[model samples]
Target: MSEPTQSSPTRPPTPSALSSRSDRQFEILILALASVIVLVFVLSIYLLGSESWPALQRFGLEFFTQRTWNPVEGVFGAVAMITGTLVTSLVALAISVPLAIASALFVAEYAPKWLANPVGYLIELLAAVPSVVYGLWALFVIAPVLSRWEQGFFQDPARLALYTSCKNLWDSGSTTLQCFFVPSTFDGRGLALAIIILTVMILPYTASVARDVIRLVPQEQREAMYALGATKWEVISRAILPYARAGIMGGVILALGRALGETLAVAMVIGDSQDVLKSLFGGASTMASVIANQFGDAQEALHRSSVVTLGLTLFFLSVIVNYVARLIIARLTPKGIQ
Candidate 1:
């Protein structure tokens, strides 16, 4: 009484169904990668915060406000280091920005193809050189030159008198203009050296970015200006620079980030002093330089934690710099580019 039942055939998946499945998988993969990056960033912050917690609790606000940093006496403060870091980085920026921009302008607009390629390559090559090598070069080669220069400058009767007057003013509790002119003990390695090295180190970052952005200025824009009988300088100043300014600034900020985080080279050249920045040629320390120099010698737990707190401070400072850079770039970017 059993009749044979026909088996139903299975159908293959439709093209649209397969495509939808693939899209979901790709989305999930991208999301997972992004999530990993976010997780790592969060974990880094957590580690720094936890390690620095003891120092934070111990020092309260004085940690950032005071200038003394004696490990033996258990005294700790960061004002000098913070000020040195800012002064060196900003001064380096001031020195390098114009040179970088000029180099970029030449490579992008003035140079022939043959010259541009080689010049650009050389500029980029500077970035690939290790920080330690630069440190050594600065120490052995640049330091002696600077030391001689300082000696010669101070030998001048007029300059020496001016310096002595400033020193007297500083010793008399005047912290304003006099403090900056009063010279520290002569040494090849100091704030001026650090600024010079930092300028060399960050120059390529800005130059590369500026060159790229300059090149991206539309050919049509240049043509339009030329058709109106605009000179080459006029075209560049009026049409190209305005369009590329935002991107160029992004590069400068990125260079600042590099300058802020630089360690060994800065530490080696910066004289490792905890005193407030008194002169351009004076010994000083930065947050990164102090961390590099002192972390190994920090035998006490609080001392170690204080060093870690410096790291935390540098981290937040870098984060703030990057965030500000993003805001500026976003605000300045042209609508057409967006």
Candidate 2:
């Protein structure tokens, strides 16, 4: 009779329901945070554009095309700054990309765990170093060494002849072209130094990203390659790199973004010259560097607005670069990989 006593039917716990609820909460939290980031970006663009409208009205389209920048005369043009920004970033990429990829391959695929951990940590730590500190190092240490090296490297007769020919082909009205024909004074306080410093600064970021992307290649893929009698280099070149190309391109764009936006280090080494760089050895100014140098001293409303406009240009450039990178990544990624 006791055993026959009725008991309430037990129900199993609803694990799927709990998981679904948790996932929805997480998705909502993530969506809210992402919305905050977009809001901040839009707010920044609005504020900058509002401040820069006066300059845009006064200068019209010439603000972008003209090269002259005189605060006293209420005249300003951003061509030199824009050219410096583009050249420094491009040269930095050219110098750093190969080194970064090589370092990533070595650390991620070849190094032992003991070596990889410390090396990777050190690479990441380089990004944490202050830009001003890098500036100081460039000014004192690298500048002197580079100044010496430039005498032999840049002043060669063949190189100068090639440069002159290139300059002749450039438009006479081109501010960037005018920079190339300038007298060769190798002070090592201009584009060359900026490019080199930027290369060093951006290398860590690119390498770290590439290393992670490369490491993401599944072990099974590598094993399959190995079973096919693939050499280490073949596996890396064909399997790893092909699979990771999209992510690597993304890393390069991120590095370019950093280079484009760099202010303190570039300002310090670029000689703070508003002139377009005629030579890599000459002093130059970038949009970010010019803004940093002049923002505090800008007295006139137009002057302040011009600086703000430069900031806006940099923001737009970053957005465009990232967008292009995304497109490239999408193209490179296979349907299965994503």
Candidate 3:
């Protein structure tokens, strides 16, 4: 049989065999770690629901659609807080996304090594700053700067004629709107401050992640673009942007979730007014802020359960928004493996 086929002993497990075994063990360990994390949130939801199932099921649809909150009477509606949360987050996104992407592009496309690294560090440092500090700065400094935008936008009789005629913040004129603008931090509350604080809070994470993604576009692709005589802007718009689109979008969704769940900074600046208003400058309260502020002092079963339900709502909203953002971006992407 061909000299017994020169039987060679199956060599003792090689390094590759050891490596594969080690990798499997490591993967199992990591999976255990990941599973432990999933357990916490799952358990939390179960416990929270366990505590409030009856209340959640009791009012049901009325609990959500009703637009009034009275703790003494136990008639709580989440409409205002929900609306405020959505509005403020949208405002933050509207303000920050373009700026964040632009900054990312600058760092990835234009800035030299010396400039990019230092500036990238500064952007990261912004994320490290405490939310309360951002709140304090926004209240003490930025609010006054932004408080002037109200009249400038709402003043035209023909433009925003739907908005009721109202004087500036100082006049104390009974306003359908909670805030009118004349540049004052004396009140220490306004949507302007909330938006600015949210923007600052989101900018670093969004921009930094985007910059990393943009950097991942291969250098050869850029060289080829230049060889084709594409202009700088044209190359970015065509090559870098399309390549990094998904990653940039992922960053944006994460940032949106951050803005939605943000509590302290928004709470500090939101003026915390319950009355819904017609203007962007109106004082507002977000769902997270309401939860953080009231969860401690909510002394009744009905009250506590209602707030918990609101918490669930906020959580679901974030989930849905991020999901939709991902889906939209995915659809826009060209068909290929990224």
Candidate 4:
């Protein structure tokens, strides 16, 4: 029995086995790196919160609801700023989404061969232009144009007549109207102008992402729709868009995020006022714009804390918005569509 015990030799791992093992190791490494990145983000939030606690504790909940922002008196609240930020971003999205989608579809599926590349390039080029330059251009050129248009429209008897009915119901003499209404003849540098600037800045981002997603639609799916005697519009509306909607949504969310955080251009064009105006022609300040305008000059402890708190608010708000957007996209897009 002892003499019959013969052991089999151990075999070396094959090339494929080694390769797979190494690939898994690389994946694990990348995952660890990503975890570290998340940790850093958490740490940044912690620091900002800690720095902002002074003002948070001082102002309490009033910090969020109050509209006054006076640094000399050490009084601050971000309601108006938050409202301005949300309004401009929403308006920008409303204006840009249709234009961006149309431009993307044209470049990806309909433009002549000679025109497509140039159009795409121009979109990218618009994105490459500096924010400061856009601000300068808006200040010098677009602002005056907008002012003239606004004044001209409001000065028209027909346009003024249309608003006369609402003016009575809304009570133009009330404090509410005083806080919001801009007299229609007011010059540029308000919510509408900021929205327009943000739209221009964000257009390229959405268009480029949409075009890429449209290009990702499987050729076979499009062919099948065509074989079913579908028109070009039908194929795109029925097949291409449904397949690429998730990606398109992601792109729009990114553009919205950029619009929310835009600082210099918004600061330069938003008139740097803390008025909580509901009208597009009324001047208002955004969180980013206020921080850009006041951070350096904020020598008071409370003033500095308030600015930091604004930044912190924006950071957390962005995270929440992105999470909600992802959930919406996931719910709207069909299973296995992406």
Q: Which candidate achieves the best lDDT against the true structure?
A: 1
Query: What would the per-residue lDDT of candidate 3 be over residues 103-215, giving only the tens digit for each residue?
Result: 99888789999999998899989989998888888877877655555556546776454443344422453444333442222353666678888988999878987897788
Compared with the true structure, the alpha-carbon lDDT of candidate 2 equals 0.86
Which parts of model 1 have CA positions greater than 4 angstroms off? 1-36, 161-176, 326-338
Where does candidate 4 clash, by residue pair? none
- What lDDT tens digits, residue by residue, belong to model 2 across residues 1-338? 12335555784344676878988999999999999999999999999999999999999999999989989999999998999999999999989999999999989999999999998888888899999999999999988887787666647887777557656644464445544644345666888889899999999978987997888888888999999999999999988999888889888988888899999998999888776666767778999999999999999999999999999999999899878767765665554555
lDDT of 4 by residue, 1-338 (tens): 22234554674444676778989999999999999989999998999999999999999989999978888787898988999999899889989998999999999999997999999999989899899999999988998998887777778887676456435533553344543444432678788788889999999988998898798788898999999999999999999999888888878997888888889999998887776765667578899998999899899989999999999998988887777667755665544456
Using all chains and alpha carbons, the TM-scores for the candidates as numbered come to 0.84, 0.78, 0.75, 0.77
Minimal lDDT window, size 10, model 4: 176-185
Candidate 1 weakest lDDT stretch, 10 residues: 1-10
C-alpha displacement of 337 in model 3, angstroms?
Answer: 13
Q: Write the per-residue lDDT of candidate 1 for residues 226-259, one digit (tens) a residue.
A: 9999999999899889988888998899889889
Ranking by lDDT: 1, 2, 4, 3
Q: Which ten residues in a row have the lowest lDDT in candidate 2?
A: 175-184
Decoy 3 TM-score against native: 0.75
Winner on lDDT (1 vs 4):
1
lDDT, candidate 3, at 243 = 82
RMSD of 2: 6.9
Q: Each candidate's lDDT (Cα)?
A: 0.88, 0.86, 0.76, 0.84
In each prediction, how many residue pairs overlap at the backbone (N, C-alpha, C within less than 3 A)?
Answer: 0, 2, 0, 0
